[model samples]
Target: MPYLNAAAVKAQDSPGIISVGVLLLFILIALQILNVLRKILMWWIRLLWWVTVGAVLVLFASIIYQRGPEKTVEDALRGARHLSEVWWREYRRWEGYQNLQQQHHVGTSQKSWTSRW
Candidate 1:
């Protein structure tokens, strides 16, 4: 077997090393994008949650103002339960729409990369 000198070894390994480096860079970039997108979505979710709670509190305050505190507690409790059920159902419906859109899109290649592995 022939020995690989330093220059010969470097030449032999350069393409593979470069390819790996490029692949790593690509993956790192993809991860960064995903992280940013995740943060943005989380921000939106938080904002929506706060807004929903704030709106409910305002509505409750209005109800208390209009009807007084005596009979409002039971009504508020029932409304809260119904509101939670409706909120989750609507959220799931919206999520299903997004999933449907994702599933129906046509693709040339590697479209299901996340699921492929």
Candidate 2:
């Protein structure tokens, strides 16, 4: 299957090993290129992550500065904590809804099976 030209593979005068050597070289070069591309992707991804985190920090700092004198670092932390709590509650609500939907489906399927019998 590797030799597309059947006559060339079977020929007595042609150098068949040269084709295999070239294929091997091509695969090696392709692997090296892929490795370099992967490294470049990783570098860019890391740089992007740093930039995002830095931007968030700057925004958070600015918000804190804009708040009245009554607001402190603890207030910011508390807000973050409250946000996490709200997200947790929302996740639980979604999970419960999914469970209810699955149960309803199962119940209907069971009813259909009983009716068929």
Per-model TM-score versus the true fold = 0.54, 0.53
lDDT by residue for model 1 (1-117), tens: 245576567767677886787899999999999999999999999999999999999988998999989779878789899999999999999999988777676533436667667
Clashing pairs for model 2 are none
Q: Candidate 2, residues 1-117: lDDT per residue as tens digits?
A: 557577566654566777886899999999999999999999999999999999999887787778853686778679999999999999999999999887997877556455676
- Location of the lowest summed lDDT over 10 successive residues in candidate 1: 104-113
Best by TM-score: 1
The superposed Cα distance between candidate 2 and the true structure at residue 61, in angstroms, equals 0.9
Clash count, predicted structure 2? 0
Q: Which regions in candidate 1 have their CA more than 4 angstroms from the true location?
A: 1-13, 74-117
Candidate 2 ranges beyond 4 A from true positions:
1-14, 68-117
For model 2, where is the 10-residue window of minimal lDDT? 7-16
Question: Which residue pairs come into collision in candidate 1?
Answer: none
Clashes of 1: 0
Each candidate: what lDDT?
Answer: 0.86, 0.84
